[model samples]
Target: MAEIKTSVTINATQEKVWDVISDIDNEPKFWKGTKEVRNISKNGNQISREITIAFRDQKCLQDVTIVPKETIKAVFTEGVIVGEKILTLKDMENSCELEALWDVKLSGKMGMFTGIIKKHIKSGTEQALQAIKEEVEN
Candidate 1:
């Protein structure tokens, strides 16, 4: 398992930041590689979506666990990869600090290239955080 942690400080209220981060529908706007989000199924607090990532012509279940205004954790509950994404928001009075912690653990042949996988994921995390910061601050 490879852990990747990234964070950005946005000049926005915690609630405002939370409003944007908690909405799965808002992801496509900020996530560059996320092409589309569809087939949303909500089971009480757990929510899952079939997402089209990039131009792969494929989709996977992105199961989410939310903690109201505090955190949003997502994982590939079923798909080619296995990992967890935990996004947390800290109220910094004047500004909010948003952090993302990602863990990737794949099986079979893909598992051998954990270093390459983690590098790509870390880049994505940085990009996503920067996008979120720009969206919230602007």
Candidate 2:
């Protein structure tokens, strides 16, 4: 399993940050790599959505587990390789720090071409972090 982790400190409260992150329907607006987010269903903290992600034109059906105001875990249930995203928010002094950890395992021909995909994923995460910072601060 390959993993990518990135973090950013936002000049906002944990609750403020959580408000933006918890909106499962607006992921495409804040996440640069996400082209669209279609809600499939939701039950409590668990949600199912179809996400069209940037690069390689990958469309994935992902199941997301959300812990309101604290954490969110998303696992790919269909398309491409198995992937998981874990997001955690921490309160620090007068600000909040958001950390995102992404783990993915490639399969078939896609497994052999992970170098290119990894770079895009990393860059996308960085952009997403920056977007989150802007949204939370403003």
Candidate 3:
């Protein structure tokens, strides 16, 4: 499993930041590699999203646990990865800080590209956080 953590501070309220991050439907707008988020199934606090990522040829379904502004945790049920990802938010004066922690385990044929996947996650996290910051601050 590869454990990656990245964070970014945005010039926006915690509420505003949460509003953008928590919206699972609009995630592709700020997230890197994500192409589309659909076939959403919600059960109280748990949500399952079928996502099409740019790096993958097929779409994958992942279960996500949402706690409003506090945290969002996700685990993939299908695709190249079979692990969990977590995103947390913190209050910092007038601005808000968002942290993303990813714990990814490769599955099947994708396992061979672990090194490439790790690099993708490392760079993608940085780019994604920056994109999120820009989207929220705009």
Candidate 4:
């Protein structure tokens, strides 16, 4: 599996950072790799959704769990990719830290290009974190 992790320190409180990251509907705004999100169902802190990824506009089914101000975990259920992506938020005295962890691998014939895909995802994740930081700090 391709594993990627990236983090950013935002000049904002945990609440501010949480407000930005927890707004899952606005995910595509910061996550360039995510083209669109369609909510299929919701149960308390858990959600089932379909995400259209930028990789050839592939659609992936994900089961997501939200732990309020702590973390958001999305596990890929059915798609071209298989694995999980997690976003964690840590509160500092006056600032907050946001970290993203991705452990995934391409399915079927696309598995051969996992190395290339890893690089792309890593860059995209860094960009996404920066975008979130900018949004929260401002």
Candidate 5:
């Protein structure tokens, strides 16, 4: 598994940040790479959803698992490659920090090209964290 982790601190209270992060539907608004997210099923904090992520001209379908105020994990159940993303939030003295950790295992033709694509995924996750920071700070 290849892992990428990125974090950013927001000058907002944990609760304030959580309010935005916890709402899975609002992801596209903050994460530019995400084109859309539709909830497939939900039972309290546990949720299953389909996410459409647009990178350049490619739109990929991902199966996502969300645990409110805690973790959000998404995997490419179908698409060019198989991969997973994990986002977590933590409180830190008058501010909140959001961390994005991604572990991806490429399969099929994509697996043969995983080395070239890994950097893009890492950079994208970093950009997503930056967007989240800006949203929470502003």
Candidate 6:
């Protein structure tokens, strides 16, 4: 699997950070890899959606679950890639730590390119984290 993990220390409370991340519709604003989002359904904190990814503008189906101020887990169910991406938040004395973990790999014949894509994914994740930090702090 192509796994990428990254984190950012935001100068804001968990609640503040949660407010920013939980706005799933605004994901494309911070995550460049995610070009667009279309919600399919919603039940409480769980949502089913299709997200357009930057890679060939591929659309992936995802089942996302939000755990209040703790975590956001998105499981990719279909498309060119499959696996999960999780966002976790840890409260600190004066700020909060936001961590993003991606465990995904290209499907079918494209699997061979997983290693090559890892670098792009890692860089995108780091950039996304930095964007989030700037959004929250300023």
In terms of lDDT, which candidate is strongest?
4
Worst 10 residues of 6 by lDDT: 2-11
lDDT of 6 at 125: 91
The regions of model 5 sitting more than 4 angstroms off are 55-63
Model 5 Cα RMSD, Å? Answer: 2.3
Q: Give, for candidate 4, the lowest lDDT window spanning 10 residues.
A: 129-138
Kindly report which residue pairs in candidate 6 clash with one another. Answer: none
User: Against the true structure, candidate 6 has what lDDT?
Assistant: 0.94
Score candidate 5 by lDDT. 0.74
- Assess each prediction's global lDDT (C-alpha) against the native: 0.82, 0.86, 0.85, 0.95, 0.74, 0.94
**How high is the lDDT of residue 88 in model 4?**
97
The digit string of per-residue lDDT tens for model 4 on 26-92 reads 9999999999999999999999999999999999999999999999999999999999999999998
Q: Each candidate's TM vs. the true structure?
A: 0.89, 0.94, 0.92, 0.98, 0.81, 0.98
Candidate 4 whole-model C-alpha lDDT, 0 to 1: 0.95
lDDT of 6 by residue, 15-42 (tens): 9899999999999998999999999999
- Using lDDT as the yardstick, the better of models 3 and 4 is 4
Off by over 4 Å in 3: none
Worst 10 residues of 1 by lDDT: 52-61
Q: Model 1 segments beyond 4 Å from truth?
A: 55-58
Question: In candidate 5, what are the lDDT values of residues 1-138, reduced to their tens digit?
Answer: 577788888889877777887777888877766788877777665566666766444445566677767778777776665778888888889887889887875667657777776787777777777777787788
Better of 2 and 4 by lDDT: 4
Residue-level lDDT of model 1, residues 1-111, one tens digit each, is 999998999999998899899887778787766778885888876888888766344466788889998989889776555788899999997998999998866545767
Ordered from best to worst TM-score, the candidate numbers read 4, 6, 2, 3, 1, 5
Query: Which residue window of length 10 is worst by lDDT in model 5?
Result: 53-62
> What RMSD does model 4 have?
0.6
